[model samples]
Target: MNHYDSIVIGAGHNGLVCATYLAQGGQRVLVLEAADTPGGLAAGREFHPGFHASVAHSVNHFSAKVASDLNLAAHGFEAGADGHSIVGLGTDGAHVVAGAGALHNASDKDTAAYDEYSALLGRFAKALEPSWFRTMPRIGSLAVGDLMTFARMGLKLRLLGKKDLQEFMRVASLPARDIMDEYFEDETLKAALSWDGLIGSRMAPRSPNSAVLAMLYRMSGQAASVKELVNSLSGAATASGAEIRTGAPVKRVVINGDENGLGVGGVELASGEQITADRVISGADPQTTFLNLVGVEHFDIGFTNRIRRLRCNGLVAKLHLALDGLPEFEGLDRPGGRMIIAPSMDAIEFAFDDAKYGQCSSDPVMEVTVPSLDDDTLAPAGQHVLSAHVMYVPYELKGGWTDAARDGIRERAIDTIARYAPGIRDRILHSEFLTPADLERDYRVTGGHWHHTEFAMDQLLMMRPTYGAAQYSTPIPGLYLCSAGSHPGGDMVGAAGHNAAQEILR
Candidate 1:
């Protein structure tokens, strides 16, 4: 018999953000979650007794900002010990942690040449970041907002007066592979940086507009992994006097419609109980929200068409492990930072083509991190958490996620690592391979897309999900979209939820 100001469906990090803000603004908010955890993709879980794993997301880009804003630290928010991923690839498997692009060719006889070459891309990121990270717009269609942002960037470059503008345009418009070719002679250096262009997408290094994907996805300030960001988000939500129920997958949302047509009424749950609210915000997928929860008949054709067209594809797989000791790469026991198991751009491209054709690569590119090497708490005493981020595995891969093939892909990816980390096989204690299917089934990622929708320029901003409807406000008033699918393109900052809550308050 209790009522509230808002009911937020889905306790994913973003949904929690929206709920916290609403509640902080004096609105009583209740967050409904289908999963048993608060962080949709950002939450951590105990993989085994005395061990936890980040199943969905592992880093927090700009998580510190969110934590500070919401006072998450005061609410028992714990910091993960390590900060960087140690990376390298190929026969040598040379390694460096942060800014690995410069160190990929660390041992190259052509060291001076490689340093100068990577410096160019570093400068490019410096120039490109401001344009891509502008404050989000107030209201507009997603396409128009992107164009406006793009044009504003163009004007800013134009003011640079011709020569600077020419270089800016070249860096902005050049294919990442093309840019890589212009700089590094070594294939591994090229492969490593080019992989950044394909993070969380279905694009290859040589793909056009892939460079922009590199620029857009990398815009987060402090968050490096999904785990860190969700930690901040979950912390913030709890601080606002809100309750989060993980593993409480809501079976259905009951609607109380007024015969007089006062724009529908409060919602009910699958338990056949009524929970009234002045507003109900859906933070799950558009398909789950409109069709599954609201019922398809409630919306007209245009709205349904737009919702149906929203792209939700999963193109990556994350595999985690606990090791008895450190994996030993050749001359890489101290493999400074992040490891990139890509030998050449062609190898990355081949994996890309395999995924596009609906098959996982027998030899896929892997980014590996052994966090316990830096932090003691992540594993049992003298043990480590081996995290591998394997990309470009299609949602509908050939041979499916049969335990055998999935294990084979796991072996291949690890074998690819063995080429770099020679004795890694000996340190193995336990392994957990999560294919795209596991991600979708566990995180409700629709098609295993870490992002609810593709981040193609067309699907950004207000055009996100639908034209003129991307800024949180839906066709039905009171409903809002605070997921990464909304705006700023899901780089693990709860910006969408944070932004949406601000709008709701206004």
Candidate 2:
């Protein structure tokens, strides 16, 4: 019988952000997290006795506005340049290093092309950046505010000038492979450049529609550790007077059916403790929120069908290795940056081809980061922790995820890494590989999608999580969505939560 102004289920970064904003707006907010700790996918966990890693090991593209608004720097949040460079590892010890607007160890033509590519994309990303944080106006809405949103978007693109605007239009929907081919001659650098576009979602270099957009989306923001980002957000939320309770699993969203139709009463805990609130904001994925927690009966047939049809099966997996010592790549003195294992666009495409058929890629491509290089606290003094985002590992394997199957993929990942770092196998003290299924179970995100759902054209912007729910407010009264499933999709970015809070406050 405890009552509050709002109840946010799941203490993911988005949820924490929404709670902080709402609390700051003078609402009595309570955030409930099923896990014993907050941070959702970004939460740090100790897989081994002395090593720590999160599903999302690195922070890229977290909202600077959100950080500044929350005064996160005061809470120990650092968002600036991700000091580490990105190195595209070559088989023959010829690596291509990408820095701000420059590429090292590439052909002269390719190097010059990279500068133009960076400048053009940088302009395009800057133009589109505001849309990511704004509430995407509902498609076909005649509301003046919605029309103004459209006008602002069009103006941003227009401000890019006729030539750049035309170029943006032409390149915006091009496949990652096509763009890379157009920009660079070095296959390794092309593959590395395209990796950002296809990293989390079910996409490859050749896959068209929104890959370039995804790349542009990630082009903004600096890198911070997941621990720092989550901790600061949690601290800010609590400091702003939002109460967060971990280990409180919501059994279901309590629904009240009156003449006005179905509405959220609050949430009932797994322990059968029902809490009351004026509104309930879900930080869980769409399917889990609707089918599992809210129940299908509360929604109409169309809404239910759309929610069910959402393509949320995650294709990415996480690999964490506890190394006895630092891993030395063939070309580099120290593995101090984000190292990409993909050799070419074809390599990425082939990996995707296998995964789309319910098989783990024989040659998996991954982005490896030795966070301990920047922060010694990740591992013991001499030891190190290696984290990688393994691509094309399907949620539903050929025969489902067996211990042998998991081990098979895990070995393949380590073997893939060992190719770049010849002595990496010898350095490994312990290894943990999490498939999409494992991610789903452990992170409480349906399909284990880091974005909660696919970031494809159909599931992005105003159409995200489906039409009626895209505005953050759900079809069900007194219920809203503040998770990655909402408009603008996912990332460590808190835009979805910030936008959701704005809508609620409005």
Each prediction's Cα lDDT score?
A: 0.67, 0.92
Q: Which stretches of candidate 2 lie over 4 Å from their true place?
A: none
Error of 1 at 355 (Å): 1.6
Per-residue alpha-carbon lDDT of candidate 1 for residues 230-348, written as tens digits (9 for 90 to 100): 65567667667766755455555555445433343456666666777777787887677777777766667888887788777778787777777766768664654557787788888
Error in Å for residue 276 of model 2: 0.4
Q: Tens digit of lDDT per residue, candidate 2, span 245-346? A: 999999999999866787789999999999999999999999999999999988889999999999999999999999999999998988867799999999
Model 1 bad stretches (over 4 Å):
63-65, 73-86, 96-166, 224-229, 253-266
**What TM-score would every model get versus the actual structure?**
0.85, 0.98
Residue 151's lDDT within candidate 1 is 78
Give the Å error, residue 134, model 2: 1.0
As a TM-score, model 2 comes out at 0.98
